[model samples]
Target chain A: MNAIIEVQDVSKSYGGVVANKRVSMTVQAGGITGLIGPNGSGKTTLFNSIVGYHPIDSGSIKFEGREISKMPVQSIARLGLIRTFQQTRIYAAMDCTQNMLISLPHRKMKFLDAFSKHGESDHAKAERLLEFVGLYEKRFLNAGSLSFGQQKLLEFAMALMNEPTGLLLDEPTAGINPTLINGLIDRLKRANREFGITLFIIEHNMRVIMNMADKIYCLAHGEMLAQGTPQEIQNDQRVVDAYLGTH
Target chain B: MNTKNIIFYVALLVLTAIAPFLFPDFRTQLATLWLMIVVAMTWDMTGGQMGYNSLGNILFYGTGMYVAAVISIGMVHDVGAYTDAGRLELMTFTERQYFVGAIVGIIGAGLFCSVTAIVVGYVTFGLRGPYFAIGTLGVAIAAGELVSNWGWIGGGQGISLPVYPGNFDVGKLFFYYLFAGTGVVLFMFLKWLYSTRFGAAINAIRDDEEKAEAMGIHTMRYKLTTWAMAAFFVGIVGGISGFQLIHFEPLETAYQTTNLGIFMVVCVLLGGKGTLWGPVIGAILFHFIKEVTWNYFLGWQWVALGALIVVTVVYFQDGVMGWLAHRKPQSPRL
Candidate 1:
């Protein structure tokens, strides 16, 4: 399959601390890719770099073969490369429907268009996405009032509102209950299948990532430790050691 | 559009139209109330709605006052000569010039402040939270100091424009209508603005800037635009105040950071920050309190005002609307 996102030799650091070093990976279009790393292993940093959240120290990031490392976060997002936070970041003061509506790309609209009401199709799509994420009932409530898992679901719906080609989820099910985790995983997979959206997920839960990702890349100490099917990476000594070493 | 809503708005409109005539003795005080409302509501645009609590919005008010005065004077006479303290002869504006100057000057003030907001926001928006607040405050303070030193525009002595070319009471009515007209338009504009997608975008920026940006919002553009719009209204009101006062100095009357500047923030806090009606309600309540304390508690007015602020901050941080919302959960949020 052709790659939707390509990151080559991407390095990022904070002051004297190096978070990611010569990190390289690619996410295939219409596929679920897993990134498994121990805490502080540069998974989030790499996600930030790919989505233009911060400037990378060195390296190249390509979305659909177009250079986007130098672009602003909003411009890169308009190109359909969007990232969610490790801690779900919904517009807390706004209701879930508002959160969804505001997530529509403002790239093509003129400044004056901002004052226009959300169109019928936009509202319909927002409702559909909310239903998809099982947040239809909570759509009218302020997002801040929702529980953490529900907020995550709302955030997921919001991300879907943009119709991103590639979605970078930072631990989508980290704080979610086990019962909800199963539902979230199912929805995520369905999004990939039905919408043909590529997903590059950073997950700490081994069983979940192993079950979801067709191919998994494991990182340790800011470097790629292994790249293989979940079955193969599960047996890799370095990947195993990285988790054990961190613990 | 229900009967109740329609009647309420009609009555409010009638009240606004007759307020100056009804309270002829307190026309000036009523005009100042509109001033407070305009500033507070505009302040809420950036401070409450967008979560960019700026302590320096008075910069626009001061700038608008100067721009309006200069434009008004420059139309009929040399502004520099008119403002020159040593000038021997009095410069006068005919009735046509007076009305024309005021209209053009007020509109010019609004436009000029909009541009200033974008320029100043470019530098200040880079600083977040308290740093942004402090940086803007510095800009206003520096402007005041600079204008005070610059003799071209009256220096620290300030500028005085020709009085309204008509009967005195008529002039009061003229300024009162100007202020009331602006306040009503601003209130209506904000009512519509808060219901738009732009409103959602700004609320998103307020909720979380990073997430808003990551979600494909041009957060900086929204921020700049919101501030510029707010400054435009504030500038217009400031122009009206400049004309009403007939004389204004750079630091005290025009800039007035310690007074009107801080009052706007307190007004927003007293009213509810993000809610549309909160600032307007808060301004009225604060103005009433200020007048009461100044009149009745003369010796302890400052102390009493401080106490009121302390109580508002500590006990009622949500302001009147928020308190009401808490009391009645069914109350609709603006």
Candidate 2:
């Protein structure tokens, strides 16, 4: 598999505490890639580094053959490298549609022309995507009113609205109910299969990542413990000892 | 605009047009009302839309006042002589000079204030929450002190504006129309602005800056742009109000923090911040209460104003617009 995202020897630290220690990984161009680690193992930090949420201490992060470590979050996002937060960072005050509309990476931004209405296509697309998230009936409801699980779905839908080249999802089902988790897993697979979009996911749940990832990278104590197919990673003694204990 | 909204706006315009003629005795008061509207509406851009509740908006208003005064003075006579006399009668002007000077002064002051906001924004927008609010407030107070000490623009003695060569009533009428027309134009523009993509983006910034940045909305550019727009309008209104005052003591009328600056912020809050009509409605109501308190309570008016602000804040925290937005789902107007 050709690497679409190359993180070669990247090391990030906070003060004297290293969060990512000379980490190296490659994501395939159009396949589901998983990063799983124990708590404080810097899974989220790695995701943040990739998406330009903050500057890394050292090393290079490239997206589709272009360096993106120094780029601003918005500019990085404009290039279709987008991410969703582990905690779900949606606009709760706005309706699902408005939240969807504002998430577009290519929305027109002319100061003078802001007075013009949003495009009908944007509204139609927002509706269609909300429907995709099983939120068609609640499109106009204030997103704050949505349940935690529904909010996650809304965030997923929001990310899709941007037509991202690669999507980095941080714990997409951390707090979701078991039934909804199954639905989300189905959608994630469909998103990868039908849309043909590259996905890099960080997750803690063994059952979920085991079922989904083409290849899994396990990080332990800010260091790469192992990398292989799900079955191999599951069998790999270091990864099992580090994280997948008894699972 | 839709036909219903069009008709509604036209009727509102006609009512405003007939306002002065209907209440000729209250023309000056009506003119002041319009100025208050401009002040509150401009303040809402930062305080309401962007959620950067700045106390230093008075900085732009006061600076615009002085900028317009100086430019108008320079137009009629040399700057030194105009400020040295500190008398409106001493500085005589032609009709051409008066109109030309006032127009240039208003527009020039607006440009200057916009630049000031952009410059100040780079430093101040980096700050968040109360740090930003207090930072702006400190700047405004410092600016007032700076202007008072500076000798060029009349120092603490203050300056007088150009005497209108036109009839006294026409002069009043002219400034009246100017402020009233400005009020109408500003209301419509803000109404349109808050409905657009730019408006949504700025509101998004107010809601969540980090999330907005993650969405690829450059929060800084939008914040600076909105602040500059707010400053430009305040600048124009400040410039025009200076000319209206004829003569103003620097600290009191032109840059009075308590009377004008804080009051503008309070007006936006009272009306219902973060909505299209909140500032407009808030300004009119605020102006009315202020006038009544000043007339009846006299020396205790400020006491009344403080109490009223408290009542508004404690009871109507979401603002009148926020309160009404919950009840009904109409756009723009009441």
Candidate 3:
């Protein structure tokens, strides 16, 4: 598979706490790659470093064969590498459609467009994305009113609206309802399959990660522990000992 | 536009059009009303929309005031002599000179403030939340002091503007209408802006700035744009007020940080910060309350202000607009 994102020996730390120690990983184009680790294994830190939320201390990251380790979040996002937060951060005061509208990162942001109604295509696309997330009826309602599960779905829809080439989602199913988890998994798969987008997901849920990802990498104590296909990682003795936290 | 909005705006236009003739006595008050609205609206741009509460907008106002006074007085009269004979108030200008000078001053003030906004925005927008507010407040005080010590613009004593060339009431009406026209334009423009991607982008910054940046918005650009827009309107309004007042005092009248500075912020909050109509309603209500209390209570006006602010802030914290937006009308059947 052609690699879309390449991280080579990246190291990041916060004042005596090494979060990601010489961590290197690759995400292939049009594929769902998963990162799983035990608590405080630097999973979120690695996600932040990859998506340019913060700078790494050492090493390089490449997006679609272009260097992006030094780029800011918005710059990376403009290049179609978007990431969603672990806690959903929808523009709460705005309605779902407005939230979707703002998520669009197209370059044509004229001031006069504020007065004009959203273009038919923009509205149609926003509506279609909302429906994809099962939020069609709540399109007009304020995002703050949505439940935690629903907010995550809105966030997912928001990311999709950007039409990104690569998406880095941090903990997409954490704190979501068990029932909604399946729906999220299906949407994630469809986004990858139908949209032809690459996904690098950091998940704590083993079942979801095992079910969705084509390949899995595990981290422990701020270091890579193992990487393999679902069945291989599930059966690996070290993975079971460190990450599963049980015999 | 929808029929409801169109009808509402037309009705508003009608009320404003007939206002000066209907109450000729209140033309001066009406002019003040328009100026107050501009202040509230500009303040709202920073305080409500961009989530950057600025205490130093008065710096632009004060600068524009002095700039207009200097330009108007310098025209058709010697600048040095005018400052020297300030106690006599003897300088004068031809009608054409005054109009030309005032027009130039107004446009110049807006341009000057917007340029200043770029410099100040770069410095202040870097600071977040309360630090930004305090930094701007410091800059504003320093600006007032700088002008206070500057001899060219008439140091501590202050400069005098030329007397109106024609009838006093007509002059008052002229300013009243000038202010009214710009107020309407500013209001409608903001109303227009509040609907666009520009509006959404700024609102996104206010809601979650980090997330807004991650969403591919250059947050600083929008923040600075909002600040510059506020500066443009406030600057013009200040220049107009300088001409209308016929006097320019440095600390008291021009900068007056303790008085008019705080009043603008209070007015925006009193109406609603982010919403378009909030500033208009807030300014109107605040001006009337101030006029009534100052007219009747004399030295006790502060007492009235304190009491009213407590009631409004405690009970109507969302301001009048937020309160109005929240209330649903009763069904006719019910």
Clash number for every model? 0, 0, 2
At residue A152, candidate 1 shows an lDDT of 88
Per residue, candidate 2 scores C-alpha lDDT tens digits across A70-179 of 99888888778788998888888888998998887653355455557788988999999888879999998889999988999999998888888789999999889998
Strongest candidate by lDDT? 1
| After superposition, candidate 3 runs with Cα above 4 Å error | A108-116, A244-247, B2-4, B73-91, B329-334
On residues A1-247, what C-alpha lDDT tens digit does candidate 3 reach at each position? 8999998999999999999999888999999999998999999998888789899999999998999999988788878888899988999988899999988765445544544656788899999999999999999888999998899899989999988899989899988999889999999999999998899999989899999999999998888889999999999899888955762
Fnat score for model 1: 0.90
iRMS per model in Å: 1.1, 1.8, 2.1
Off by over 4 Å in 2: A107-115, A244-247, B1-4, B85-91, B327-334
Q: Which scores better on lDDT, 2 or 3?
A: 3
Model 1: how far residue B217 lies from native, Å? 0.4
* Per-residue lDDT of model 3, residues B224-264, tens digit only: 88899899988898899888988777899888887788888
The residue-by-residue lDDT of candidate 2 on B1-334, one tens digit each, is: 7899789989999988888888888888999999888989988898888889898898888899999888877876888766764455455888888888899999999999999999999999989999999999888888888888777788887877766776888777888898998898898888778878888888788888788877777788888999998899888988988888888766887778878888888788888888778888898999999999999999999899999989887887777787787777654234
Candidate 1: pairs in clash: none
Model 2: what TM-score? Answer: 0.94
Best by DockQ: 1
Q: Which ten residues in a row have the lowest lDDT in candidate 1 chain A?
A: A238-247
Model 1 has a DockQ score of 0.83
Cα deviation of A115, candidate 2, in Å: 4.5
